[model samples]
Target: MKNLLTILLLTFCVSVSAQTTRKYSNEFMNIGVDAAALGMSNAVTAFSHDVNSGYWNPAGLVHIEDKQLALMHSSYFANIANYDYAAFAMPIDNNSAIGISLIRFAVDDILNTTQLIDDDGNINYDRISLFSTADYGVTFSYARKLPFEGLNYGINAKVIRRVIGDFANSWGFGLDAAIQFETRNEWKFGIMARDITTTFNSWAIDEEEFATVQDAVEGQNQELPETTELTIPKLQFGIAKKFIYRYDFSILTEVDLNIRFEENNDLISTSIASITPSFGFEVGYIDMIYLRGGVGNFQNELQLDNSEKVSFQPSIGIGFKYNCIQVDYAFTDIGDQSVALYSNVFSLKIDFSCFR
Candidate 1:
């Protein structure tokens, strides 16, 4: 199993290097943060008002009432990989807010078998070792309300770091801009533009470590891998509304359109761009307990029989809020409607007012 895993990893790396433009570069950062937003299939772009908004729609940060802290954790691939997130947000003034967030995704303890077959064509179990691959991101965000009522704008500066044990590492930078608007009638709209400046990653590979695997496979690893990776811009547009049936009961519905400037398997694909639409709803009682559900990641997949079929991911979650603390739980798919098993995600949020 270890050897097979190593082969797979190397193959993936080679394939990525062969391509001039990778469609999924730095993909781990695309994974949604905050259990509540994940449960809603990331449909909260229009109304993500709190510390979590730093990762969703930074424009919502202006809605922060006070100092806030957030945390989340999830496991993927049956615990082979772990994803974690944390964030802090505070009101800088009456109409401005600032926040910082961090995210990490990692796969640890993978057996390195390149050295198993030592010099002289001898198999040596003692040569085996272990290593890990991990990706990290840090974002600084700021938001302020506009002079116009119910209008706000925000921006984010992101730093990305990736490591593959001692073999390779990279550093990247990017920027994002977003805006949110609300109407007197409670309808909301938002736009989030990610990688607006086209994120760039520069990698440094240890040639000595990589040399061990150069001959492990035929016609592969013949050249050094590409040192630069680029992530193009993506846009998300959202609209939402809330319906109150009484002072204590309410329902919120939202829709989001995600646009990528590439042709892919998304439900709506074209040579210029691809668009995927997601829908979600939340039901709340007395602002204390909540239930949420969503469907997203619509794709047209090719079957083994040369047929095409539509598939989507479905997610559900629950949340509880009391005073200044809130906890949320979600069951979601990390894959694009491909994985049979789902992952559980949990997140917590606390308002500093609780201490005062």
Candidate 2:
């Protein structure tokens, strides 16, 4: 089973190398950051207002009141892959903010079986080794409030790094732009454009290392892989409103439309684009304790009986905040509503003012 898994993974790597522009490229970055946002099915575009906003909608960073730091960790695929995120944001002035964020997703200790069978045709377990595949993203964000009240704009400069052990590696860069607007009645609207400049990745494969795999596969992987990969643009539009009940209780609700310029099995699919709608809400008590829930990633799935059915992912979470420190937890499905096992996500946030 281990050797089979290695072969399958390597085949996938080779296949990916054959494509110059692929859908879902650098998808690890789209898995999202903060647990609070995940709990809400990533519907926080218009509602994000802290360091985590660096990933959700950078324009929301203008709402940060102080120096803030955020961290999150999650595991997927029965703990075979680990995802981590960290971010920091500070007010550049009363109307502007700057932030930075980092994300990493990795599958570690994968068996390297290219040499499992020695030259003498002996099945030698001792020849097997281990390696890892990892993807990393770093983003620098800036947001400024417009002269018009309640309007803000932001931009992100993103750098991406991917590695498949010592066999392959790539470097990528992209740009993002976002805008947020709030009404006097507290309604919020946001738009985020990812990879607005068309992210590009250039891969460098080690031919020497690949030769062993080529020999193992027999008649496959005879040629070097494609060196370039491109990721097209995607958009997210969101609207939200908060209702304050009595004096200490509140509820915030949000809806978002995620748009991809491709024909896919999304909830609303067309020849030019596809749209996936998401809904989320948060309930809070005394501004300290919170409960969150959402549903998103609607897709059409073919059942065993060859019937098409609509499926969605649901997530729930809880949060607590005291002084300048906050912690949150969420239970979410990472596998597009198909996997039975769910992932648990946890995140922390701190305000630097607490130290002063």
Give the per-residue Cα lDDT of candidate 2 at 209: 84
TM-score of every candidate: 0.94, 0.94
- Alpha-carbon runs more than 4 Å astray in model 1: 1-20, 121-124, 217-221, 334-337
Give lDDT tens digits, candidate 2, residues 23-61.
878889899889889889999999888899899999999
Angstrom error at residue 312, model 2:
0.6
* Alpha-carbon RMSD of each model: 2.1, 2.0
Candidate 1 structure quality by residue, lDDT tens digits, 34-60: 989988988998988999989999999
lDDT of 2 at 94: 94
Kindly report which residue stretches of model 2 are placed more than 4 angstroms away from their true locations once superposed: 1-15, 18-20, 122-126, 334-336
Per-prediction count of colliding residue pairs? 0, 0
